[model samples]
Every structure is written in structure tokens, then in C-alpha cells.
Target chain A: MTKKRLTPPLTDADIENLEIGDQVLITGTIYTARDAAHKRLVELLDEGKELPVDLKGQIIYYVGPTPAKPGQVIGSAGPTTSYRMDPYAPKLLAIGLKAMIGKGSRSQEVKDAMKKYKGCYLAAVGGAAALIAKSIKKAEVIAYPELGPEAIRKLEVEDFPAIVVNDCKGGDLYEEGVKKYQK
Target chain B: MREISVEKITRTVRDLCIEAACDLPQDVENLLRQAKEREESQFGRYSLEKIIENVELARQDTVPMCQDTGLAVIFVEIGQDVYIAGGNLVDAINEGVRQGYTDGYLRKSVVEDPVFNRKNTGDNTPAVIHTEIVPGDKLKIMVLPKGAGSENMGALKMLKPADGLKGVKEFVLKTVAEAGGNPCPPIVVGVGIGGTMEKATLLAKKALARKAGEHHPDPKYKELELELLEKINKLGIGPQGFGGRVTALAVHIESYPTHIATLPVAVNLNCHAARHKEAIL
Candidate 1:
């Protein structure tokens, strides 16, 4: 339950320090990607092609935000479920993806990769879109503009709040948390 | 002996789409509040509190409660004595969805095709419209924007009639447990029992459209709903499965008669955001 602050271009020590259930407020730049974009990124990687953006020591937020209104920075922008991206996560982690911000439990494969690759998985409040969007000061599609919501966007965030779900040490709040409260 | 224009329906549907996405209904809000008060885990309480804050923000501003503004699913009950004027009902509804998503700045989550070409329709169009012919001279339209986080976790199973009520309870619990945090905890579970396979799934969807925390009119069903709610909360999935009590806000069930050999059950999970709005014309 301890609260921490993070500014990305995170280091190995940063990933190793986060534990399950600790609250962290993130600031600085994070990239956004949905499943479709993940597919393309991994496909590019498989073919030994360079990525559109540098992901080393960066966070990728799994979201497909609603379009912003006339005077807004972004629309309702909450985390989507993480499991769908599990197939691509290990590959991204292998390539130095430091952390992921999403909702829901991820597969064991993703968790194992996190442990091995010094990555972490964070969970934002799933349906708290407007609240989450408040932290995002700027967003622009860095890649795949044709993908609409699924488009990869570079975001400048300020105090974006999330909790560590899967840390580098193989801690999973979804498992331990439920076990503690299960009747 | 009454006529309603498709243009009017379109306008109503469009407004409903925006309203449903931005506003968390009172009953649902109350349930979330209750869950927050009851939640023991620090993480669970924090999540519930944050969700409530998000709900208020959505209500006060022109913002959606969730970014996954979801597939536009419409339910219409048209009176037999009513004449529809101007245009095709389905097309009008889709047009409404298109206008609402565009004007409202909601995400267009619909895909043109499920397979082979997984492409977004870009307008959140061709809504899943379910129509029913009723007895009165009025038409009712209900719009629910179903997010895939919970919708993807839905399951339907055809059990042998011999499995009985015990079987139904077990299957429903299994579905929820297997779903884990994927559907988002503090969910609203809609259980549909009996009828054909598709009918059961449809019934489950209809059950979700029912007011959250409202009991079935039938005493037997109401008791079952209560029982299921208690059991689900006991599972300790909590809010967001960060874990503690209050895994679900409600368990609303609808049932219909089925074939002698079949006892089909479907579970439709709705996240805490569960957005729906309606109008009577």
C-alpha cells in the first residue's frame, strides 16, 4: 500500500523495486498500444525490422481511448484487460520493454517473462477512464494512425496512478490478494 | 393506433448512446458506494473510491465512464398497433449509433468483420438491435454499450435437465471464478437459465439490462439472485480482484421454459461501469 512516484526511462532498479499492491504515480512519457498494434510491432520484430519508436526502458499503456472533446487533452482513457496482449508481451519484454499499464490478470508466460526480463505489470483502475485521462497531459499518435483507437500514441503523463500487479520478483497481487480475503 | 417516426427513434437512440456512456445510473452508483464501505482490503477500498470518483467525473462532464464505449446493443419493444414511419428500423438505429459516437467523441469499438479482416468500422455502427413486438401502443428503446472486458468473459453451457438447480449454481460460480479479474471485479452478473442455447444467452443479455440491485419479480428467482450474490461476494475477488469482499454488486437472473432434455445457462458479466439508458416513445 506504499505510494511511490515514477518518471519513465525507468532503470532495472526501478522495475526490481516495485512490489505487488504498491501504489505508484507515474509521470513523463509512456507509449500506448492495443492488441492490433501489438501484433504489428511483434510482426515487425519477427522480421528483424526496426520499430517506429524506441521502447527501451519505456512503459506501454494498453488502452483504446475515446476521442477527446473540443477542449480536452484526451477522452475517457482507462486500461484495457492485459491478457489479450500476453502473446506479444514476452517479445516486447525481451526487447527491453520495462513496464506495462493495464487491467486484469496476465498469463503465467507474461509473469515469467517479467521475472526474467526485469519488467513489471501495473494495473490501473479498469473503468476509471476520465480519472486516468486527467493524468495524461499530451497524446499524439506516434505510429499507426490508421488504427483509430488502436493506434500507437506517445503520451506525456503526470502522476498517472497505478498499482504494481506483477513485479520483477514474480509477485502477483491477483493471486495473493484473493488468497488473503477468500472465505 | 399510433405512429412513431424513424427520425425520432434515431434521435432518441443517439442521445441514449451518449447519456448511457457518460452517466453511471443511481442504482449502480449506490452499489459501488456500498462496496466501498464494505471493502476491507486497502487496495480494494482505494479502487472502489477511485471508481466512484470516475463516476462523478463522467456525470458532471461530457465524458465516458470508460474508454471502451463498447458495442452498441439496442433493445426495442414496438407496439403492434404502432406504425413506423420514414425509414428502415435497423438502419435508423445504426445511423443513430454513428451520430452518437461521432458527436459524443465516443470510441468506435466495432469491427467490420470478426475474422479474416479484423478492421474497425470507425463509426461504431451496425448496432446489435433486438426488437420485440408488444401489445401496447408505445415503443421503448434501451441502449447498452457493452465493453469487451466483461463481455469477452461471458459463457453459455447446455446442461442435462437432470443436473437441476444445484448444477446451475455450480456452473455459474465456475464461470465467474474462471473469469477471475478479467471481467473486472465488483461486476454485475446476469444469469439466464433454460430455453435454447441462443435464447439463454439472449436472456442473459436482457437480464443485464435490468436495474442493478433490483430483484426478480418472482420470489423464487429473487431468492436465487440473493443467494448467488452472497456466494459471489464470498469468493473474495473483491474490487479489481486486488481482493476482499464485494466481488459483485448484483446477480440478476431471468429464466424461460426449455426443452425436456436441455437446461441451458448463460452468464453475462458486466463491469462496474455497466452503462445503459432508455426512452419510451
Candidate 2:
């Protein structure tokens, strides 16, 4: 299948154009965060403090990459299950987060927020970390180094592949796909 | 009595950890390739292809196949005539895990406590070790780096004898269906029937260490395994749960005799990664 190429700093139009199950090849900058980082980011928001990184028009990848070996930009990095971030996702979406890249299904609250906020959720193939890493040209920890692998990192990616699992219109590929194929 | 140095055990454990992270065992790789070929859905085929490629890339670069390098789970079979010299076996295993996580650049995912502290353990030490005593003089060790995505999807049920086989099948199906896209399919379903609650869970985990597509020794259980595998794949959860004919690469069942009044069942899932490695000393 042909994949639509998407670059970060996505506009509302970009998100609206996506449909559940559409293949995408994402290019440009994305931020990395997982369970621990999400907790801290939400905490900062609750405290009425500035976030370490801006959420506006930015995409956050739910991943905790293995340590990079010598001479490598990053190690195998795949999407973790996305539901763990459901609690914090809507809050980020409210702040203008345009999209998220992760694996698995999102909760109803997060899906509703995506529809209301003109955001989308994309799924990178889980257990395909080495292939995903090939798309990342550079990575540097931008915050919470103490969180180790969970630290927030700025990544420059090229042709990073994902599928639109939840679209702004409230379509869910997971549910739709399973229904289509279930015997 | 045969004496084995703690130093040797530690070093071997360390090597196994690195190997388990970097290499997708041939059994798993072969199963994935077959699944890729067998998958009917276009998206499912695409996911499997990517998984296969990831395995190749991880092996070539000596990097982990997936970032969640997992909690180090060690299984050791100690011979009755053998003795571990120089240190306690548990400490030696933990030390090995420390060295391996650091040296291999694998992620340290363990938290010190489940609820209160929730602090990172730093080195992925304090491995969940299971020991069994056998009759030989050799020591056998197996390391399974279990990622959390699938691990968190595990389920257990204590049922009355009246529940029977029908209850077991329904429970397994419900667990996988509820899991949906979350457990990182196509998953290996490890089912444990009988035993006490904890024993059933352990048996389910041990089931994962078996070769994919291999059936239980008993003809009865093997037939049940095939039946369950068919039912699960028919669910169309697919690769990464996108929907396809290849939702499960295998269904493994390990059972133990149970009390007259009790029937306990546990399900443990391993993602497509399904990583494990072993050594004999």
C-alpha cells in the first residue's frame, strides 16, 4: 500500500485529512516520552509550570529506547502500548498537541479528545524496534535525564512509518479492522 | 559432589542476557517467517514483514529487537550432586543481570517496589529466578527477557471443578479478545491448567519457554492446543492486532494434577519478540 508522507508540526488540516487505517510515513521532529515522563509532564502542567518541551503542533512517541551503543544514534526503539498514557493524553491534546505515535488502542477519553481537538493517533508496529530506529537520524535527551531510557528525547526522523489508528473524526482502525476480518 | 564456581554461573548468566536481547531465537524467527507467509490480511503481512526485518537488523547491529529489554527472568535446573561454590546462587544471578544490562546496553526496566517506592532498580537486577532440582550433575540455565506489554495482559482464574474444559476455553478467548491490540500480537498464548494459583501462573510462564508450534506430549492436550490455536486465530486479532488470519503463532498448554475441588487456570502471553536463551554448565 502507498503511504502518505506526513511531516511534524502538523496543522489541523493535516490531521483532518487522515483516516483510520491510512498508512503514513512520518518525517521531521518528534518527542519521545513513556510512562514516567508522562507522569512528570502532567505533574508540571498541574503545578501550572512550563513544560520542558512545547506540546503545540508536536508529536510525542511513547517509547523507552534501549541505550545506544557506541557510534550509534539510537538503539532499537519501538512504540510501547499507548493506553498507559491515556490519563495524560487529553490534557496534552487540550494544549494543542496535534498527534501521537504509539502502539495499541487509546481509551475513549483520549479518542474523544482527539475528535474535539483535531488530533490523531498513529501506530508504529510494535516489536519492530530495530526497523523503527533506522528512521531516526539523530536523538538527544532533552529533559529528565534521571529517568534514563524514559527521558524526553528530541528525535529527527526520516520516513518513519506508522498507521493512523484513531482519526480526528472518531474512527478507530483497531475496532474496524478486527470487525472486518473476524471469522 | 560436583562443584561449580559462582563466578562461572555469573559469567554464563551475563552472556545469556546479552544473547537473549540481541538474537531472536531460530524457533521464533522461523515461526514469524511462516506467519508472514500465512497471513491473509495485507496489513498483517506488512506487520510481520517488518517484524522479520527488525529481527535481522537487531542481529546484525547487535542491538535489542525491542526497547523493553524486559525484566530478567531466570530459570535454573540444578543437579542433585552439584554444589555452587564461592557465593549464594541468587546473589550471583543478580550480579550477572547487573553486568549484562550495563554491558549489553539493554534497558533497565525494574522498579524497586510495585506500589509505594516505584523507584528504578538501575541495573535490572533481582531477577525472578525459578529453581528445579534434577538427577544429573550439570547445571542448566535459561534467561527470558519478558517485556511488559504482553506481560501486563496475563490473567488468572480460580474455578470450580464444574467449570470444566468449556470454562477454560471461554476464559482464554475472553482474555485474548479483551487484550485486543495491547499485547503486541501475534502473541504466543501460554496456558496453565490445574495446580495452585501461583503454581499455575509459573507453569504458564514456563510454557512460553517451549519452542513455538511444538505441541504437548500428551495427545489429548495436543489436540486441545490445536483447537485453541484455531479458535484464537479465528478471532482475527492479526499481527499487532490489526486483524488477520495469523493472530497467534502458537498456543502452548502446560498442566499439573489438581485437587478434587479446585481447578485453577492462568494465561501468559509473549509478544512476537518472545525472546529466550539458555546455557548448560
Candidate 3:
């Protein structure tokens, strides 16, 4: 598999050629949200109320990270399971939300949205939070402070590593990879 | 009777919580190494390497091993002759939980209400404590910080005696297969067979606290563990569900004598970072 470097505010061209199993190192700004934050974001959309941040062509990382100790930029930060966000992903992707970094599989609706919206799903190593935190250079809670760690935070990252799990072309590494190795 | 101070239990619980949260258990770590050596898929192998590296970073830096530090599940085995002095036992444990989550900077994932309010408790408190009275005067405390990732995927089933061993096996395999990558592969499958519904689930969870890679004392359950482990790895879920030959590191089954007609089975899964730390006072 080919390795590629990416920056956020991604365009269709930035992800169209990416296939499942391709390794990527993302550098730039990405937003953080978990199941709780996604619910609020979607609620705002349904009410026609503007969201706190523009999601267009941006990436969302599913994480709620441990509290950072003194002198640390962030604490252990890794991807949470992605399926819980499936109910809300199609709506976000419809609004130009680009890639998502998380672990586990997504629902069929999410896969369809990725295909239609020119977005892809990336999988970071689950439980590799401390290692993942090393790539995050800065973090701030831009919205929903009441949600505690579930609050929406903007993070600046450098070479944040992940692998393409689902792609715009409907390729799924989970399905293909399992079939290849199943005895 | 030996009198043990509440202060000592609190201090011990606090330290155990931090230790379990940050350090991947040594036995589980060794199993991952073996899994890595045998992995045929390049992606699976690469994923394993990163996990190994992350475990080291967290331990060396005294940081949480994962972002979801998880809820503290404490198992306390107190000797029948030991008298807990100075304070109520439950209160002392919660106090310890508050301190450990705070001092360790572990994430507070617990909610004040499961259905409503949904507010963070600020400090992780009221750990799920399971206490048993044992035969000796010593008190043993074990903390397993269980993450929601794997815990959410657990399942329980009640089968007729007719279903027997075959049905139980089918249900377990199905649970793990459907769980797939969600629980995080290279998982430990903890099975509880027999007992009532709640009892079975408790047994399943407690089974996870058992040291990884050790078989049940009974020969029948021990054989079942080995067979299930082989079947699970063959499913090709692999490391991170990327597909490989090492989907599960161990399968531990804890069983109890059952009623004549009912066989209840429960499954609890722990991610590759299967962590548990204990202290005996």
C-alpha cells in the first residue's frame, strides 16, 4: 500500500484516489467529537440553526481524550468506536465533512454517504492513545464545554497516522482483509 | 479477627486503579507479542507493532494507555475474620476511586445518570465494587478499568438444557463474530456458563479479571476455552479487525453448577489492553 501525507479542509480530489488499506499521515486542523457531540451537531442542523464551527471539507476525529497533565499538550487521545456516530454521519457528510478518523466499522448508510459525498473513513490504532497524543500539537474546546471531554475541540496535528478503512470508491478493508485471511 | 483500617483500603484501591489504567497486564502483553510473531497480514502486523509501542509510551510516561481510561471495576475479596475499621467499606472505595482518577489524570467517563441528565460526575467515583467473604484474614483488592468499547458488545443468552454444549458454542462464536472489530480485535473472550441472568453476566465480567491465558481449573471448561480461541482467530478479524490470524489472544470460561433445565451463558470481552492490578492487605 502507498503512503500519503494529507492536510485538512480536504477537497474531493484529495480523497478520490485514496483506496482502502492506503496509509496516510494527516497534518493540519481537525475537530473532535464523540456520540454526544454528534447528537447536538445534528440537532442544530434539523433546527436550521448554524453550527458553531464550519465543517466544510474538514475532518472529524472521534475521541474524548484523558485529561492532560501539567506541561502536556493533551492526554492519551485515540479513536473511539465509529458505529455510534453512523446515525449522524450522513448528515454531516452532506455538508462537506471530509474524512473521519476512528476505529471499528461503520453502518451501510455511512458507507453510502462516503461514496456519495466523496469522503472516506480512516482507522487509527485503537488503544494507541498516548502515541496518538504525540502528534497533536494544540487543542481547544471550541464548543459545548458543558459536554466535558465530549465537547467539540479543535486540534492542530502533525503527521497524525491512520489507515483508510472505507473509501469513496466503496472499497472496505475490513471486508476484503478478513476474506483474504479467513481460513 | 484482624482489624484493617479504612485508610489502607482507600490508598491501596487508589494505587491499583492507576496501575491498571496505565499498564497493560504483563501476561496480556506477552500474548500480543506471540500474536505479532504469527500474524501473516502486513496491516495486522503493523497494527500490532503500534499497539506494542503505545503500551510502552504510556507506561514510561505514566500517561493513560488509552483515551478512554474506562470505569473502575473493583473486586474485593475480604477474609471472613477481617474487620474493616474507621469507615464504611463502600464509602472508602469510592473515595479511593475519586483520588485515583484525579491523580492519574485518567478520563472521567462515568455519567451521573445513565438515562437522563447525562452529566459528568467530575471525579470518577462509585466504582462497581464486588465484594466476597473468603476464608482468611487478609483482604485482596483487584481493579480492572473496563472500557466501554468492549463492554458494550457483551451479550447474555438463556438456552434450554437441550441446546447443551453445541448451542452455547454457537452463541459465543456469533457474539464475537458480530462484535468483529468493534470490541477491538485481539480481544479476550470471557464466558460465564450457568447461574441466573445477572449471575451469569457477573461471572462473565469476573472471568475477565482472571489472568489472561490461564485455563479454567476444570478440564471440560479448559478444553472449551482452547477450542473457542482457535475458532475465533480463524474468523479472520485480525488485529484492529484488519484481518489476520490473531483475532483473539485468549478465551477464558468460568462456569457454575446450573439448574436442571436452564443453561444461561454470558460473554464479556476485554480489548487487547486487558488490564488488571491487585493488592493484598
Model 2, range B189-242, lDDT digits (tens) per residue? 999999999999999999999988899999999999999999999998899988
The deviation in Å at residue B5 for candidate 3 is 0.9
Q: What global local distance difference test value does model 2 have?
A: 0.93
lDDT of 2 by residue, A124-153 (tens): 999899889999999999999999889999
What is model 1's native contact fraction?
0.88
Residue B246's lDDT within candidate 1 is: 87
Please tell me how candidate 2 rates in CAPRI terms.
high
lDDT of 1 at A178: 88
TM-score of each: 0.99, 0.99, 0.99
Q: In model 1, what is the error at residue A98, expressed in angstroms? A: 0.5
Each model's lDDT comes to: 0.93, 0.93, 0.93
Runs with alpha carbons beyond 4 Å of true place in candidate 2: none
DockQ agreement of candidate 2 with the native complex: 0.87
Q: With candidate 3 superimposed using the best TM-score fit, by how many Å does residue A176's alpha carbon deviate from the native?
A: 0.6
